[model samples]
Target: MDEAESAARRLAWGVHNAVGFVFTLFWTAGWISLALLVLLATRRRDVALRMAARCWAPGLTGGAGARLVVEGADAVDWSRPYLLVSNHQSVIDICALFQAVPVPLHFLLKQEMAKVPFVGWYARACGMLFIERDNPRAGPRLRREAAALLGAGHTLCLFPEGTRSRTGVVAPFKGGGFQSAIDAGVDVLPVAIDGAGDVLPPEGFRVRAGVITVRFGAPLATGDASGAAGRQALADAAHASVLALLRRSA
Candidate 1:
């Protein structure tokens, strides 16, 4: 293409993204408010989760002109609770997961997220767990709470990398989620998400249209495993599964 045409296309893309970003803000706020009211009135987490998984998440992605392509979602037994460990690449990964995963999933977030404005309020109301990573007492507390949540039949999603990968590469996994799975006697499920980085890169506010793929792997059992050694083993296995899925998706 000529220089003039190329420049025009770039400007158009930027304008499109800016408009989408504004629309996303309003869309998210409206849905979160509706979900919050449902939670308050019914005190049923399933109601809120259904609204998010079936409505808000998909709405945000669709409004941004993004499509969700999921594979192996049937591999997940929605009837049972499992700890979902996934590789994180972008903020939009959360939306993709919620849209693709059939089960009601709660996130394991940093305790500080509980203080954010709309997000914090909605997260707390949805029964999401937050942990103070730096506080020494937080470890045992998190495990205890996680076990209880699992026992209560909620599927908790954890990004074992702890943060988004700027390079779109899967980072090293942390053992905390695996430990919690072992404590709760629940299986650990590995999910791989791709293409979200192209939609919204780390620290970028604008959302570019793209397709995001979410692939689920077989569940890794943390059977009869306990303590540091068991946690490390489970983490390694789950990481390997996720990395393999990433390769396949590529």
Candidate 2:
């Protein structure tokens, strides 16, 4: 590489890491402080959500202010529990989504993340559901857990795609989260996240602050059907919604 290009690349990396570290440090401190206060004082749902909002506010403001441009953000319902399913592009997609919908958020994460240092503990404490991808009974277990959460009237944020897109194109969903929503009789709110891949692509340490739009479409109600055919139907519809948003922006 040329000297100028190499220098620019190095500068980008340095800025990205420096900004990310500072952001994480502040967010972690704020989150732990709020959590402790909440844990000590009260367990009211609104208070808990307020505390979550505080912890999330910094990242949300910084991320959106620097990179994200949200559309259809007003469609999010703060008063009800909806099964929010989105297309995953990169890890920063989480921040974008949280910024868009700053409610009491719970993630349907992979079991692998449950082993991470502080993230796992935080996720577990916040009642995040972790699915073991390899287990034979994982699907059924997740369904049961999801149903319990649904019964309690808590919203869930899930990536039906199950993993980040290697290419920028959205991939097929695993059908587990969809089936759980169907079983629990909840509507799936389709979220389309655009430009996150360009902002922070998978397998890259550098970040390019750019406009990332998150669109919320009409929710899909639970269908009584089951098996491959039923799951595929939901997947197709969800995929179509995201594709439509992307095409519109394009």
CA displacement after TM-score superposition, residue 70 of candidate 1 (Å): 1.1
Query: What is candidate 2's lDDT per residue for 1-250, written digit by digit as tens?
Result: 9999999989877886678757765776667566756755775545555565555644644643456677776766667777888999888787777667756777889999898765676667678899888997777888899877875778888888878997988887767577767767777788898888877778754566677888888877766557868877887787788778778788
- Which regions of candidate 1 deviate over 4 angstroms? 1-10
C-alpha TM-score for every candidate: 0.94, 0.86
- The regions of model 2 sitting more than 4 angstroms off are 1-12, 15-19, 60-65, 76-78
Candidate topping lDDT: 1
Please provide, for model 1 over 1-250, each residue's C-alpha lDDT reduced to its tens digit, 9 standing for 90 to 100.
9999999998988898788788877888888999999988999888898898899898888887789999998767889999999999888888998988787889998888899777899999888999888897778888888889987888999999988998988888988767778877889999999889988889777677898999999998888677787788888888999999989955
Give the clashing pairs for model 1.
Answer: none
